[model samples]
Target: MKEKIKKACAIWNPIAGNVRRNEKNIDLAIDFFKQKGYEIVKKATVGPLTATQIARDAAYNGAEYIIAIGGDGTINEVLNGMHDTNAILGIVPMGTANLLARQINIPTNTVKALKSLDNVDIQEVSLGKANDRYFILMTGIGFDGYIISKITSNLKTKYGKLAFAYHATIESFLYSYPVFSMKINGRELTSAFAIVALSKEYGGLFSLTPKANLQSEQFQVCIFHKRGPFTFWKYFISALFRMHDKLPDVTLEYADTIEVYSEEKVWSQIDGELFTQLPVKISIVPKGLKLLVPRTAKHSFPTYKESR
Candidate 1:
């Protein structure tokens, strides 16, 4: 009788972040996996959500591990396809803002992360869903979403993280401070913008939702009640000092589900990619997916406990 061969498939974006540097590291990663007795298959994404199609097909063919090799956006696509599969998810953070990698203490350096994966811990974590789509990180609505949509691929490729700062600085003046309605826990609230966070980190090195963590079953919602540019400036300053939670106009709460809509068409960004337009219903799917996390990241996923 022939023994079954171990298999792993990597779905990556060829143009994500620093392409040349990422590809160089990716080559090294493939060779390492090969030496570890896994038959590795590489799939490069050509267009938006191409990773999803690749991931699904690979998993269907019995790949034991579905590895995503790029930024959080790339991971988001692969995850959507393989989240429900029996295969475990592995990440190689090569994108500009590896927020999820940073949040979980996964090595941002590809080679280091690859070496660590051999003795990793398996964790089943919750994921947030916006209507039909699933997101691993936080989702931004209103102003931030508008900014994310306006950022072109060419801009991100050239300026990296600076491109976001450039776009936000210019777009903030043009933004109209659109208000949206949200229903959470049977109470109606209005806000200029909101962020439903499943992870503690929103952007790299910034903790937007303090109570959020990968181990938690629910999201830590941050809603900005005030509108206008001045209010945004205040929030910005407060956030830099990590004092925004104390602001009178800001509210923080934990919830399993939230209903959001706007009077006009407002955009949304899920896991750093431009997602569906407004009227999105966001909720958490508890222990929805499997992940291979290095034990060095053990501090990130503390035992889940209900705070309420």
Candidate 2:
């Protein structure tokens, strides 16, 4: 009459954000899972892409649940290493901008996020792939990507989310806006900046793509036609007011695949992590990832015929 114990692996990033605080929270998470009869295994990442390697090993070893204790970048890495496994993904949100956690209604507070694991509400979600890489949230080219590329590790460690804002301000004045040709599901379009988003939220708080839903096998592509200081300010203000979609120069469309090319080299970002240069292909992977969410969370995407 006793329940079976589940194997749970925690991939902790000790230097993600607020190192001391994150370490304490990770300790609490381990204790909580152990109390719930989970056979807990811990792995601490020391450098870039370490979480991905650790996650792959855990999945191959038959871990029932793999929890990432960092930001969106860490979660993205773990997802990439997960392969087509049965392990469910969980988030602890220990970074400056936990956009993935926010989009899925996961608690930003580390303790609360850990406690939500008790619900065991597992769901299969779609993911966006840029080239060979998989992104759980969104990807960007031009302005947003340039800003992320400029934000160094030292700045992030010292100023946290403020680092993004700082670089964005400086880049807005100096960055030369480059034009890119985008083919969205075969429809050709040109834009100065583009964001292919799978979630409604951006930077943890702002809702740049209000119609985006992670559970659906579709992406909300936002294209900005103009690129200048004034234009950027206008877009920023519109985003703050949640009316960017109404702007004349801004276009929002839904697509299952997108291909982008640039005459000149431009940066690209995936899930807040700096990725490769321009000339990339992006597509949606249907029901690609199994994620753990709160039982009470409301999904924006329409329900499928079968629930996982």
Candidate 3:
């Protein structure tokens, strides 16, 4: 543990709203690590894919631990940069809805989270590979993707939680259903919406795929075939209640891989960033990412039974 803690890279996204507001918090985190006798190389990502390039360079320079100091989107970029490397990953989770960090029970308090890293229990989490890029959370298409497209950084910075709701409201009025072609575990179907998830949670708190596990090799792909204003509410309710599979218009499949296409070009978003457009091929890489989680933390799961 001491050897692994010697040299580390702190990959920071200075422009991330949460991080930007809590600059002093992160500075204390840096000081705390330095006090613990770790040689920390601070790298701030300037723009798009900057986090990835910085992480790749840090890894190449023999950084044993790559610590992410931004949101899940930042972590996603770092994962793509790692690309099959055997380096341990750590997280400080300074972002809107740090789903990955929350899943592993890492507190959002920058200093506390960094201190927890010393006693981390390393675990292997699954990675969703699209084309060649990696996504730490779920991949979205259709209405949700369109909603993401509507969210601007300025709006997110101004409104916070209401930003998504506002963007969704606008999207609901202006956007029509997207025509999708999907292949799940060999069967082909056309749908208006699709979500292929590697983690159990979506949109921070929603348990869209409650039974899904990040450490598991399988991916849960939920497809909604219905189109209309009510269709969004129906699916949204199911996701809100963690009953996505039971939605009347929804079909759920568990497979190692899935492919998605569309008659017209449809945009896709992964871990909050606008990703490649369809036709996309998504595959689950079992135990691909080595994540540093709290020693006492458990993977996020659904509370179905009264007693565990």
Candidate 4:
């Protein structure tokens, strides 16, 4: 563990939800590392400047380790910043939910998560790419995107997990589904809802794609062809329990690349942040990024299971 404590850069998001680490805590973390003769470069994220940019600069400046100090969104940005680069990425779960951290067994306690960094295990992980953007968790279209777009950040901060459910329920009632065409690995199809997952944990620790593996070289693609608002609930339930793979209305496939075309623009989200609309091309970069996991953390793999 001592040998692993080389020069590391800690990139922190100052406005990550409701995390309340005071000046003392930061000082303690910094001091602890410094006493061990580690050169810790602390950089706080300012408004609008993505963590990826900060991470890129850190790597370009020769930082061997890049620690992301926020929620999944922050980690996603950091990952994007260091994409295609051979740099080690670490996480401190400071934002709401910290789904990625939980999945990797990183302690939510800032001190312990930081201490565990000494024994951080490096794992090559897969990422989902939409156009030039990379998603660390999952990407959604159709009804899922509609629900995401409807949820306000203030509400999410105030209500935490319930915010998504509250907004999803309202969107279910008010938002209408859009018919679209999808092509998975060059096979043509149509669907109103689609989920391309790279990891098992969706937004609130729920598994949207039970068989999705972060280390796998493929993406788990789920497309719901049924149209109309009534059909939204059916797919929603399937996604919740990750039992949607075997439904007659669901088309589940594993692929390295997928192209989505729509009669009109389709909404999309990656790692909970809403991005551009589709006619978008999505793909998985197999073992593209090296991530830091706790020493005790064991990576989970997917197995085929019959969904009734």
State every prediction's TM-score relative to the real structure.
Answer: 0.95, 0.95, 0.91, 0.87
- lDDT of the candidates, in the order given: 0.85, 0.84, 0.78, 0.75
| Best candidate according to TM-score | 2
Residue pairs with backbone overlap in model 4: none
Lowest lDDT 10-mer window, candidate 3? 299-308
By lDDT: ranked, best first: 1, 2, 3, 4
Q: Please, what are the lDDT tens digits per residue for candidate 3 over residues 1-308?
A: 54545688888888675888888877877787787677898889888898998888888888877888888888988888775787778888888778887777787777667766667666777888888789878888777777767777777656665788887766765677878888877788889888888777777758777667776688887778888777777777877877877766788878887888987868888987778778888898877878777764653532111111
User: Which candidate do you rate higher for TM-score, 2 or 3?
Assistant: 2
| Each model's Cα RMSD | 3.3, 1.8, 4.0, 5.0
- Residue 121 displacement in candidate 1 (angstroms): 1.1
* Backbone Cα, N, C clashes tallied per candidate: 0, 0, 0, 0
Report the lDDT of model 3 for residue 20.
82
Please report the candidate that would top lDDT against the real structure. 1
Better model by TM-score, 1 or 3? 1
Off by over 4 Å in 2: 299-301, 304-308
lDDT of 4 by residue, 189-270 (tens): 8888787887777776456676778878888877788976567777777667767776898877888888887878679888
